[model samples]
Each structure stands twice: as structure tokens, then as C-alpha cells.
Target: MAMPVYNFGAGNPDPGSFPSQALAEATARVLEGAGETLVTYPDPKGHPPLREIAAERFKKNNGIDLPVDSIALTTGSMQAISLVCQAFLHPGDSIVTEEFSYSGSINCFRKFGVRMIGIPVDDEGMNVDALEEALKDLARRGEPLPKFIYTIATNQNPTGTMMPVSRREKLLSLAQSYGIPIVDDDCYADLLFGEPAPTSFYALDPDSVIYIGSFSKIMGPGMRLGFFAAKEETLAQVLYWKIDGGTNNFAAYVTAEYLKDHLWDHVREINGIVKGKLDTVVQQLDAQPDAFLGHSNPKGGLFIWVKLPEDVDPVRVLELATERNIRYGTGKAFDSQGRDVKYLRLAFGYASHRDFEEGLPLLADCVREARAITLEARV
Candidate 1:
């Protein structure tokens, strides 16, 4: 059977909505001035000016108050996570993360043979009680404590749950008490739709938390640009893992120029558009509350995690939806434990309202069909 071509699967920004004109102009200007620098082996620590600019932006917008000496540019935030994980974690060390986490980060930890402990989450974000219990259990057994608590603090991926201000403080305090570091993934923090987002975890525990940011969600994914802010000592350790020979100088230059010009403003514009798309999807989901249960009402982010009834098979629905020209990320791809079969990660940022409205009915129908099939198999 021919599959439908709807692509709610991708988490990337809409191509038509990217600031191509501004980026093109900035890239051209940088290239003209870059001369031999673009061709030569770049600085191993990344372009200095770019790092400085990123540090300034973080301080201004996120209240991070970081110095250029505390920042390191990497190919992407994914690379930054990998480097940090490699630098700090030993083979048997365990890392604590949310029950639902960014799959890529989980995979990276797996590569290093590091154990991962999935802490439960609630409306306030990661459940502090659950984490405390886990910590206590590990301590009692004389097991090695987690090296760090990695979290998507703002506009968390998949679930789109942002940790509230009080929760942030509590989480930081817990980490401090345990003497473990916290890796705050703030990549989606800028996409906030509410009045004002809470300050990052790094701002709260500047000395212990490593802040990771990226231009992929704000600018474009292909830009391959990200930066991290940490304590000078931790950042120095991260630099020791820089096997990229040097940083991607051209990307850094382009990002620096773009920020100096209008990148932040452009982000606000994209946020506004994405907000509307999210609202439309939410409204659609609301209209059929029985079919889609346990989903997030995201203030701002690229994805909506929908929990369908247990009888609905996401893989079968994905297959059927694809046949009707609609697609979404099946729960299997995001589930670290291979047990979340009733969930689906739907991205609305890439599709227009008209497309969503047109395709949603087909998606609903696909779900119904999957539910029916499951019932039949049970019978």
C-alpha cells in the first residue's frame, strides 16, 4: 500500500518561515570578510568573537551572567551533551534524567556504558519526591550516586513541560545537596509563549549547572551551532574532549553576525507563529478529548505529546496515517524503555492551520481504525 505523505514526524522549524533573507545577507557579509580564516583550521575552542557574543547574549536574555572564558562552542547542543557526558562520566557512573527525555541524550549516555535512572515527572516538572527516593535508595545500597541530573528545563522536548520557578529552585538545591552537577538543556527556552519565561537553572546555580543552548531551534537546524556555559573548571574539562580538531568557525561567524543583527527579534516572530499553530492543534485535540488523552497544553514548543487510549496502537496508526498523507513520530522512537505504546509526539510548527485541519480528521480516523484492530486482535 502507498503511504500518505504528511510529515508531523520532523521537529525542525518550517522551511518557509526561516529568516533566509537575513541569514543570507549575514553569511555573505561574513564570507567577504572571513578571507583565509574560513579556509584554514579554525580555533579548537571555536571562534573567540562568536563565543564572546554568545556569552553576552546569555547574560542579557537568560540572566546567566557568564564570561567568555566560561563558554565553549560546539557543533550542536547534542555534541555539547556528548562532550560533557564523556568528560565527566565514567563507564559505571549513572546519570539521572526525566522519565520522558530527549532520546538523543539517552542514546549518547548509552554509548558510554553509563547507566541512566529515569525520574518520574509531574505538573511541576520532574517529581522531586521520586528523585529523592531514588537517591536515598542508591545511598543505602552503597551504589555510586548519579554524576548529574540532566534536564530539559524549559519547553522540554516531547512533553513540552517547563519547570516552574519554585521547582527550579528546589531542583537546584537537591543537586547542590547531593554534590552533583545539573546539565540544563535550555534549547527550547526561547520558544516560550507566555508573558515571560522563568530564569534558567544555570542562573540559579551558576557554579554547578552546565547550560546548553542552540541555534538549531531558533535559527535553523542545519546551522549546526550550539554553545554551553559552565564553571571555568568544568568547561576546561569539556575543552579537553574537543576532538573536532577545531570548532566550526564559519557557523560561529554566521551565528555571531546574525545575533548582532536581528536573530533574537526573528525568534520572537517565529514564536508568535508557532503559538498560533500550537493553539490550533490544541483546539483540535480538545474537540476530541476522548480519543486523545493525557497530552500537554504547551505554552510554547515544537511538539505535543499525545497519549491515546491503550487500545490504540501508535505504530499501526502511524502506518495508516502515512497512507492518508499525514505522519507523526511514533512513541517507540522516543521511549527509552520500549513500554510507552499509547503515546505519540505530534509537531505542529511545521504544518499550516489549513493543513492541520484537513489532515487531523484523517489522523483521528486512523486512530479509530487502530483501536478497532487492537480490539479484534484481543478477541
Candidate 2:
């Protein structure tokens, strides 16, 4: 029999942890209370109660005192981001993001025909100094400044690093000086294992920041609920592009009803499960340190970025692993420039415990073998 494929590529939440029963109950409650409203379309901005609940949660969690009207629900955070891009970007315009980021955003930026400048990132997330230097260089070269700085500062995707509030302050200061906007993507903010998230950029200066939040991480992505929040003036621009009539009204009602009562409790439960899965991947990687060079120690989020030996080509490692029925995301996908080939993002949340226990060792072995093969070729 063939060994089962272990997929560690997609940033999918654990299927086992999805609260099906709770959602079903919530769905029933919504129907009983407002079943008649289904005949009419929902508010274009979204269900008012859902927006109110999201605003309250943002205030409670991110320390942002946002009005409910400023919040616009979307199909997912991707759509929220798409709306922002549509509002601000024109062809030949410029934008900035971390050197390594979510591939989905990278693709979105490319689709707009805008120039994307990637700044170096460290453990604390985007290096603000590097960002400032890049901005200064653009000015020196007589180039236009980027329209906005887009950052996944909280539990950043792929790398799974969080930016400290100090860094956030510095970044905001730079944006202010340059007269640029900041798109703060906080989709993974609630997935932290235990550490408290830093103050968000929107909280630091709501006037200059566009905030994005989502239920895809703590809840299931299939629910398809996420939101965008900004000052009324800024939000008004993006709302023009959110022309999908309205996001799914039924999903909004059910999600809001469920999360209003059980949001934090559900967050804690999901974090516990994903954190344990992360521990498994770390433990396996730690056991064979010689096979790898370095890996990120993420406090929270769904991924661990592992860097391979210099000689070990990730393409080759992936090729070998694929033949063995294993799957993972390549670092190049997350890189806007497609130059990073030594890194792999292991998404532990989507895989089962048994998949990690069995597949991780096999993955380590593949790396060692790839490294040996690379060395032999170098000889």
C-alpha cells in the first residue's frame, strides 16, 4: 500500500476542531429570530448586529474604538484586502510589504500592476529601519513613494512572527512622515498560543491605518466571514469597491450570534489545538538539528518556517517529498521576488497528529538525503 500523503502546505484550520454543533444551534436561533428578513437583501455594509459585534470585539481585543459603521463584512479577509487594493492602487503605483509574506496577498498586489517593494524582515516582523531606508532611497532616486505599507504584523502568515508595539509605533511614524497609509492585516492575531498581542497600528493612529480582521483562523474558513475597519473617510473609499451586494447575510448572522457569546472561549480552544500541533512539528525538527540550518520559533499562528542547509535546494527536497506522498509550501511562493529557495513553510494546523508524527520524520530524512545529494553534486 502507498504511504498516505501528508499535506502541510495550506494554512487551513484543523477540521476536527470546527464547532459544527454550535454553528448549527446558532443558525437555528437566527432563523427563529429573523427568518422573515431572508426575503429582503441584507444591508450592503453587512448585518448591523454583526458589524456591532465586530466593532465591540475590535475594541476589546485590538484597543481600537471603531464605530460599527466603519466595519464592512466580506467573504473573507482576502476580499477585505482586495477591497483595500482596489480603493488605493492604480497601475504603476507602488506598495511595500515584508520580504516574506502571504502568497495570496503577493498575487493580489501583482494582479493590480503595482510595483511591490519588499523590505527585510527579522524575528519581530518587518524591519522598520529597512523600511525607512527603502523609502529614503525611493525619494533619492526621484521615484514615487508607495501608496501604502501592507503588513501582516500580528502572527504573520508563513513566518508566524509578531511585531512588537514599539516596532508598530516606529512604522506608523514612518508612514506619517512619508504621508502613506498602512494596511494592517490582523487575520492571525487571535491565534496566538499564549502571549498578548501588541497594540495595533490602527489603535496607535486610526486616521492613518486600515485594519483587517477575520474569523477564518479562530473559526473555520468555510464560514467565510471577515471584516475591514478604518476611519469613516478612509472606509468610504473602500466601500465603493465592496460591490458584492452584501457578504453572505446568513453566514454573518450565524457567525455573529455564535461569536458574541463564545468568541474568546473558542479562540482559546483553537489556539490550544494548533499550539500542540506546532509543538509536534518543533519537537520533530529539534530532534534532528543537523538536517536543517534554522527555523522560526513562532509563539502563535499556523506555520513554522524552516530553512534548509545552504546546499540543499528546496525544489529538490520538494520533488523528493512529493514522490513520497508528502506536500508543503515553498518559501518562494511567499516571497514576492521568488528568490528564496532554502525555506519551507510547514503548516501544522491542517495536518492530523498522526500525520505530523509519521510524516515529519520522513520529511527530515528527505532533507538529509537532499543535503547529501547536493553536497555530492558540489564535489
Candidate 3:
């Protein structure tokens, strides 16, 4: 018999929640109306219509005026990360990022022989004070400054923490002081429930910050659409490195049509679903006080990062979870050095209500089992 699996990992969206009918209708319309324009070899920068939508949405939300020429569409946001590294990173060079960041990005930097200098994150998000100290120490030692400070400030991965605007301003100030650039991945910014997320770094300082946004979470990940907006000078470099002529023009056109007026409604619908999942999981975890450590509901993000007792090992906990057909992402995956941590980054985005009701308690049981085994070994 097959195992009854409950996945609490992967930042993917709920498959059932996708508006496939709308997408199909839009796709048919795009081909019928714009097939002649889109079928040809597409521009590397992006389809002009998609770029305009991206720019308009960004400016409308953040109140920042960004030129359409500054936006570049990618196969996905990971492509944007690769282009950024290719443009700025060299072997043995370093970049600053939250201690816990997207693994794909961390791998991208490491593969290119760039180093990740991790800055600690707290409840509010990346600590600007700590960043200043690190920056000062590096200058004092005459060490080469990082290529840029890569951050996912809006909906931080693994930690699901949001950086307040004050810290963002301070970070930008420090980066300016050090002459470092900022690569802000606002991938999860639009998946908000309440008050809008803090202003983006690019909104505050376009000249120094490269901002990224995605249509995956809003429209569903299968769309494979994301955008990067930077100053013209920086955008030129990204375009130069865009080896693939362009992403699927049909995808771009269909998404542009769908987002033309329905974006807010779509975001709100998905946010309600994800927010409900988060609430359900948080409630269940709260009930298992001994087995599960608590985490506050994030302002707006896909994950709810949970802590464990000092003696509990996430690896062991995962081992126990697997036996029960449950899967969750542990913090070690996000750590560059693969250090042990009593933390789990449970993504509620894709999980269903059943996954929560069943998996949460199973997770607590797994944790308790792991805790007892570790305690016995210590004894």
C-alpha cells in the first residue's frame, strides 16, 4: 500500500485554487487577437505589454515611478537571481543576505564562487544594527565589500518575517554609506491579507535597489512568470545577460490580459485561502504546546516558521515525520553551512485544510518522538 503523504514543504500554491478557466479563456483570446505579434521571436527584455502592466502595478502600489524599459521578464524569479549574480559576482567575492534565505539563491551565489555573509533576522526581520556592525568590521579589515545585499524583505523565506520600513530605511542608508547595491526579491509581496506590506526598497531608492516580483503566487506557479525592475543602467546589464531571447510570449500576453483589471480580486481571493490555512495550522500547533514551539502569524507570507525545544533536532524530527508520511522543510536547508537548527519552515500555501487538521497533530507526534529519542541518547 502507498503511504498517506501530507506535504508541509515547498512554497507552491494550492493546485485547486488556480483559475484555469479564466486563464484558458485569456489564452484563447490572446492567440486570436495577438498571435501574429506574439508568435514571432520575442524581445529579450520582455513583451512590451507585460512590462507596462508590471510597471503600472508596481508604481500604483508603491507610488514609485519606474520606466517600462527598466523591467525585464524572466522564465522565473530564479532566472533573475542568476542574472544578478552573473552581472555582479566574481569568484571568491561575497554578498550580504539574511542568514536564512531562499536556497535556490544561496546555491546560485555559491555555484558562482560568491560567498554569502549572513545577517541575523529577528521578529521584525533583518537587523540593520547587526548589518552595520558587519559592514564596519569588513571595512576595518579592508575586506572586499559584497557585490550587493540580497534580501527577501517583504515575505522572508523560511522565517516568514517582514522587515519594517524603519529598518528598511536604515538598511538603505547603510548600503549607501558602504556603496553596496540592494537586490530586493519581493516575490511574495502581493500575497497579503491586511494592510499592504512595507514599501519596497526599489520604491525608496530605484538607483540602488533591484526589485523582483512574481505572478506565480497570484495566478499560480505553473505560469512561470516573474519580473525584475532596476535602473536603466542595471537593467541593461540584465538584458545583456538574458541568453534566452525571451520567455513564452503567449504566457506573458495571457497574464497581462488577466491582470489588467482582475489582479486585486485574484490576490484577495488567494490571500483569504492562504490566511485561513495559516490560521488553522497555528491553532493546531498552539494546542500541542509541549511538542511544538510557537510562531506568530506572519504579516503576509507563505510560511509559518516554527521553533523547537533546544534539545530537539529538526533532522530527527523529519525522520520521524517521514515514517508517518508527513513532510516539512527544516531550517538547515536554508543555512549555507547546513548547521543544525530546531526550526521548521512549514509552508501552508499549498496544503489543504485536511493536510492541516491531519498533518499538524502528526507533526507534533513526530516532534515528541524525536525529542524522547534525543533525550535518551543524551542520558
Candidate 4:
């Protein structure tokens, strides 16, 4: 039997769903005028027009009050994160992040040989009590205080929990008292599914928080365009570290042109489609109450974290699901210790509900099979 190839593992959106027509039109306009400039090494900082458009969008969407000079265009949000890590961290410097965080960010810190301390999180996001304790513990040990606290404040990945406004304020206060900066990753903020999107942490603490945003989720990841906003001082410091020859000029040009021409309307339309598919997945999982122990109703973003019963080993289930043509990310991938794993991060933005609806039942069956196998092995 041929195994199915449903990839719920990656956070990528369906390529066909991207606004190809709109982007194509935008690219044509740029290419017509981008003559010798396209062949030359572009601005090291970024294309000025794109930075201006990004500044406007940031103010409109995130309520960040920043001039265009405060924004730096990067190849992707990943590159922005790397720049921050490199600029702020030294051999003995440390960072505080959520207990379960974006694996890519963790890998970046590892590359710098910086110490990472994972703060525990609850439904509201990173646990405030745990953060305070961690800070105090570091202080008592005579260890260097964390240079910055990195967070996915809104629509957090994996857990899909939005950090409450009060918690954001509290975190800012704690970091301020400790003289620590906050790196706010708002890549998924614009995808809010409901009314009253929370104000960004950058809006709350513009002076202390450096904000990173990406069009990958909005336009297409393949575009590899993202921006980081900070106070001029920090922006200048970070810009010095951008040794990518000339700042990603082509990406900036395409993104700037797209935004200036108001092509985000098409992007918003794609988001609507994603939201519907996300709702369908939630509804389907809701119907199978016995199989799904706990899950998040993501307000925005592409992923939902599902907790399964104790007997179900999500890693084994993921392997079994591969045999059946379905794929998922196991809890261990997001955890530090990678033990007692029973959670799965499911991405619903890329596939049709029909795909998930058909594959989910088989996924549930895989869980059952994994549990049975564990019991058999133990006996």
C-alpha cells in the first residue's frame, strides 16, 4: 500500500494559496524601473521606501510609534533573530526564553554559545512567578543577569497562547528593574482571528523592547522578507552587525513596492481562508472529545498545540502516522528534556479541511496503535 503524504509537520502555507497574481504584478512594476540599481549592491541598511512602508504598517497594526529609521530590513525573521543574538550576547551572557520555544531561536543561541534558561509557562504564557524566581536565582548565584528576555508575546508558537496585557506589563517591569532588554517576536501577531487584538509589547515598552516582524506569514515565506524595529540606538547597534554584504536589497524592494501599492488586501484575503480552515480543524478535534485531552483555540497564527492522554506517545504516534501518510510534530521537538511527551503541534493553515478531516481519524488511530505497542512491550 502506498503511504499518504500529508505534511502537517511544517508551518508552511500552501504555495498555491499565495497571492501570486498580485505579487507578480508588483514585481513587474519594480523590475521595469529597478535597472542598474538591481545589478549593484543595494543599500546596506535596506531600500528606504520599504523601510518607510514597514514603519507605517507597524504603527497601523502594532501601534508602534517609530520613525522609518528605526526599522531594519532582514532576509527573514530568522536573520533578524541571529543579528540580535550576535549583537547582545557574549560567551558568558545568558538569555531567558519560554520553556518551550521556537526551536530555530534555540539553535541560534546555541551557535553563539550563549547560555539559555527556559522560563516555565502556563495558559497565560510565560509564568510571571517563574520568571521572577529565575531572575532572583541568577542574582543570588552572582551569575550574569540575562541580557534580554526573548518572547513570542502574541499568538505564541506551539502553545498558541497570547500573553495577557497585564502579564506583558509585568514582564516589562521585571525586565526594566533587572536592566534586561526584551526581544519581542511578533511574527504571528497580525493573524489575530478575533476582535480586539492585543497591543504589542513593543508598543508597551518601545524603549526596552526590540520588535521583529515578518511578511512570511502574511505574504509567503519564500519571499524571505522581514523587519525589526527598535529605538534608534539599538537599531544602530544591530545594524552594525548586519554583515550580509548589502542588506537584503531585493527582498526589501519587492516588499516595499507591495506594501506601497496596498497589496496586503490580497494577503488579508488569504488569511481569511486560513482562518476558516483553522476553525474546521478545531471543530473536528472538538467533536472527538475523548481523543483530544486539551488544545488551544488560536486567535491567530497557523498552529495549535494538542495534549493527548498519558498512554499516547506522540513520537511513536508520529512515526506510525508517517506509515499511514500523515505527519505531525511531536512534543519532544518543542521540549527541553523530550520525555513523557504527549503533545502535538498541528498546522492547519496549509491543507484543506478535507485533508485534515480524513487524516485526523487515521492520526487518532495511530495514537491508539502506539499505546497498544507500549503495553505489549511492557508486558
Candidate 5:
């Protein structure tokens, strides 16, 4: 039988780690307690208990007191981004984003027909200086400042770099000075493996930041639970665009039931699981330095962004990877322009640990193959 591909495209939690029994129990409790509520439409703002609980948990974890009025539940954090962009972005309007970012959010913004201004991000996260420059350049050109700055501040997708506290402050200062709002995606913050990474941008400037969080990393994506906090005015507009009437009631209720006490424990266990995957994959890649460039040593998350050697074409690497039944996300996916980038998002989530031990070297081999193709093309 052919060796099945290692799927490293999704930043999903390990399926085996999902507390199926716990969730099952939670579901039973919800149905037995209030089965009728599930059939009724949930509040467009969100189910009240879920919102209240989320606000409490957020404050406990991040030191940000997002009141119930400021919060709105969504199908997933992905939907929160959509609601913001749909309500704020118009055709020809501009928004700033990390040079490397979440592909889903990028794609979602594009549908609004807004222009995306890419600001390059680094180890400590989005370069505030570059963001200032980008904003200034737009202002100088007489184009209106972007409607908002969209960012994945912690455990950034594709690139797992968290924005350091220093940069987060600078960023807030710059945005506030420019009167620009921020769409902060903090979905991956709870996945930290080591010391706590940093506080939410919303914590520093709650009024100016629309903060989104999710249970996908800590609980389960199938739960379809994510929520956001924003200023009253901004949140009202966001809810107006939330045409779903409400988020999934049963999923939200079950998650609310599951998280009454288990949030931190579940997240800690997943972090260790993800860390083991990261360790295995990194060890294999370390065997061939010249084959690839450096990767982010994620404190905790599903991905390590690997830069390919200069001569290696990412498309060629992908071509060879597909042949070998190895799947990975190219950095190109995260870009609005879809320009070629010499990088790959290798998700250690979802895929098996044994697959990591086996697939990574094959991935490195593909890198070498891609380099060969580049050399051949030049001849």
C-alpha cells in the first residue's frame, strides 16, 4: 500500500486528544436541562450565558474586562473576521495586514473588494515601524487610512511568531495616533507551551481593538465556537452584519458546559502534544541545514513556518511533495497578491507523530529536489 500523505495543511488539534466523553456528557446535560433552547434561535449577539462566561474567562486569562455588551459569538473566529470586514471594508478601501497572515482572513477580506496593504512581520510580530511607514505612505498618497489593521497577534498562522509586548504597545500607539482601528485575532494565545507569550492588543487598547478568540485550539473546531470583543459602536455594526441570527447554540452550549472548569487543563495537554510534534519535525529538519532556511520555534501552536533555500522554488517543492504524498501550505496562500514565496507552513497538528518522524525528511528531500529543478531551469 502507498504511504498516505501527512496532512500538514490544517492547524487542527490532534483528534485523539479531543475529550469526546467529556463533550458527550456536556451535551447530555445541555439537552436534559434545556432542550427547547436549542430549537429557538440564539441571540444574534450570542447566547447570554456563553457571552457572560467568555467575558469572565477572557478577563481571568488576559486581564481584559470585556463586558457582555462588547462580546458577540460567531460560527468560528473566521466568521468574526468576515463580520468585521463586511461591515467596515468597501470596494477600493484599504486594510493593513502582516506580510504573512491567515489565508482565510485574507480571502474573506478580498470578497469585500478591499485593497490589502501588506506590512512585513518578524520575530516579535508586525513591524510597528513598517506599519507606521505604510500608514504614512497611504496618507501621503492621499488615500484614506485603512478601515482597520487585521492581524493575528499571537501564534500567527503560517508563521508562529507572537507579537511581543513592546511591539504591541508601539503598534497601539501608532494606530491610536493615526486614528486607525485594529482587528486583533488572538485565537491562538491559549495554546502557549512555555512562559505566557503576551497580553492581547485589546488589553492595551480595548476601545480601538476588535479582539477575536476561539476554542478551536483548546477545545475542538467541531464545537464551532469563537467570540469577539469590541467597542459598543463597532460591535453593534459587526452584529448587524452577523446575518446568521446567532451562532450554533448546541455547539456553544456544549462548549460552555465543557469549559466550566476544564479550559486550562485541556489547553495545557494539547500544547504538550503539539510540542512533541514540533520537536520531532524540527529534529529531522535540523539534519539538513542547507536544505531549508530557519523556522519559528513556536512557544506553542500548530505550525512552524519554514523558509526554503533561495534557489529552491516553492512550486517545484510542492510538485515533488504531492508526488510523495506529503501536503503542506505554501506561504503564497497567505498573501493577497499570491506572489511566490520561498516558505511552507508545516502544521504539526492533525497529522500523527509517527507521520511527522517519517514525512519531514521526505519534505526535506523535496526541498533538495526543488533546488535541483531550479538549477536545471537556469541551464
Candidate 6:
């Protein structure tokens, strides 16, 4: 008999928490109320009510007063990112980002032929000092300023570290001094647990920061809804690049209707689920403190980053994990230079409680075996 497969790789949402009944009810209401609109194209900026809802949510959550015109709905945050890349970047242009970042965004930047200058990240998130030093170095070499500073400040992907407000202000100051704009990705902001989230970059300086958020993390990714708030000038450019006739109207309408009534409650429910999973992951990792050197203690996020012993080979771990029907993300997958092999990200969002209880130990065993192999090689 084979061991059951447990995939801990992708940051997928827990299906058990999905608001299926609520969404179905919302969908019926939307169709009954505005079925006629389906005959024509959706508003290019997205369903109008959805935009208003997005802006309202933004203001309520981040304390930023954004006009609806300054927000554009996209298929998902990924599309929003692509639109920004399309509008702002030319081949050989540069972007400043964390040393390890959301791989999807990294891939998107690569597609645009943009150079990414990576800065180190600590517990509080991107190290502003390193960013400034990089800025100084570029200026010293007479290089053009990067197109923008991209950051996933709150509940950052893979690592699960959130930036403190002080760090955000300093980073904003650096961008201002360098005459560079900031692309602030806050898709995971709403999912934070335990502590209150820090101030948003958009709220601190709307003019200099292009803020992006998504329903994927809060509601569910399949809903495929995301939006960005920026200055009118920035929004205009991003809109021009959004060639898709519009984001899905059906999803937008249903999501807007559901969120208007149940957004916070839904967010609380999902956060509880993810937090429990994260706790389980932490506990499992704690059991093997020797094999897993250390892990990030994210306040609220879908992943926990684990550091393996120095001699443990990540490739060998992956190979062993594959045979055992376990999967995870390597640190190199998120690295700007694709050179790191000392870390791995275990996603706690999708796996069931039983899966985490059973699978994580197996993953730790794989690491132990890999470490043994490396030690034998050394001998």
C-alpha cells in the first residue's frame, strides 16, 4: 500500500472555509438584479459597484481615501502586477525588491525583461538600510533609478514576515528621496492574525505608492478578484495596459454582493482556519528542532519558512519527499538569484489538520535523511 499524497507546496486556500452558499446566494441576487448587463461588455474598469466596494473596503481597512476612479479591478492581483509591469517597465529597466519575494511577481517582472535589484529582508521585512545603500550604489555608478520599489510588506509570501510601520515609513522616505515610486502588494494584509497589522504605505503616501489588494486570500483565489489603488495618473497607465475587456463580471458582481454583507465575518473565519494550520506546522517543525534549524514566526500568513541544517541538501530532501508523496517549495524558488538552497516553505493553507499531523513528520524525516547523505559524503 502507498502512503497518501499530501501536497504542501502551493499557497492555496482551505476549501472547507470557502463561502459557497453565500456566494451562490449572492450570484442569484446579482443575476436577478442585473442579468441584462451580461449582454454587453463589463465596465472596462470592472463592475462599477465592485470598484466602489473595493475602494470602500480600502478606505475602511487601510485608512486611505481612494476615489473609485483611482482603483482598477483585474482578473487577480497577478494581472494587476502584470499591468503595472507593462505600464512602467521597458527592457533593461530595473525594480528594487526583497532578496526573496513572491515568485509569481518575480516571473512577471522577468517576462517584461526588467532587472530586479534585491535587498535583504529581516524579521521586520525589507531592510531599508540595504535598500538605501543599493540606491546609493546605483547612483554612484551613474545608473538610472529603478522603475519602482516592490514590496509585500504585510504577511509577505513564503517567509510570512510582516513589516513594521516604522520600516514602512523609512522605506517610503527612501523611495521619495530617490524619486522612485513604490508598488505595495498587500494581498495578505486582511489575513493577519494575533497582532494588528501595521499602517499601509498607500495610507502614508498615496501619491508615491501604488497599492494592490486581492480577494483571493480573504475570500478564495478561485474567485479571481483583485484591485489596485493608485494616483489617477498611475491608475490611468495601468488601465491602458489592462487589455482584457474586463475582469469577470459574474465573479465581480457576486463577490461585491457577498462582501458587502459578509466580508469581515468571512475574513475572521478563514483567518481562524489558517492560523490553526500554521500552529500545527509550527508544532510539527518544533518536534524536529535539530533537523530544522529554525523557522519564521509569522503573526498571520499562509506559510512558515523552515531553515534546514547546513549539511542538509534541499535537492535530496525534495527527491526523498517526492517518493513519499510530500511536496514543498525550496528557498531558491523564491530567491532573486535562484541560488539559495538552505530553506524551504511549507504552505499551511490548503492541507487538512490530519494531513499536517501526518505529513509534516514525514517531511522532517526526509530532511533528516538528506542531512545524513550530506554527512556521509563529507566523511
Displacement of the residue 265 alpha carbon in candidate 5, Å: 1.5
lDDT of 4 by residue, 65-120 (tens): 66777788888788999999878988767899888777678778878887778887
Output the worst ten-in-a-row residue range by lDDT, candidate 1. 332-341
Give per-residue CA lDDT, model 3, range 313-362, as digits (tens). Answer: 77889888888888888888887556777788888889898889988998
Please give each candidate's TM-score. 0.94, 0.96, 0.97, 0.94, 0.96, 0.97
- The count of residue-pair clashes in candidate 4 stands at 2
Give one digit per residue, the lDDT tens place, for model 1 in 1-379.
Answer: 7643566777787667787787788899999958778878877668888787777667766665677777888888898999998899889889998877787887788888887888876655688778888998998999999999998877777787877888888888888988989999888766778756777888777898998988777777788888888888888888889887876888788778877767568777888889988888888887777677768877777988888987787778888887787878777666655465688888888888877777776788888899899999999
Q: All candidates: CA RMSD in angstroms? A: 2.1, 1.4, 1.3, 2.0, 1.4, 1.3
lDDT values for all models: 0.80, 0.87, 0.85, 0.80, 0.84, 0.88
Query: Which residue pairs in candidate 4 have backbone atoms (N, alpha carbon, C) closer than 3 angstroms, thus clashing?
Result: 4-325, 193-299
Model 1: number of backbone collisions: 5
Tens-digit lDDT track of model 2 for 164-202: 999999999999999999999988877888767898898
Better of 2 and 4 by lDDT: 2
After superposing candidate 1 on the true structure, give the runs of residues whose Cα lies further than 4 Å from its correct spot. Answer: 1-4
User: Tens digits of per-residue lDDT for model 5 on 1-379?
Assistant: 8778789888788898999999899988888958578778998777777788778767866776878988899988998888888888889998889988888988888889988888887887789899988888888999888889888878888788888888889889888999999899888877777888687888888889999988787777887889988988988988888877688888888888887778767877888888888888888778768886788878777788887898888888888999988988988997667789888888887899788888888889999988988999899
**Model 3: pairs clashing at backbone N, Cα or C within 3 Å:** none
| Segments in model 2 whose C-alpha atoms lie over 4 Å from true places | none
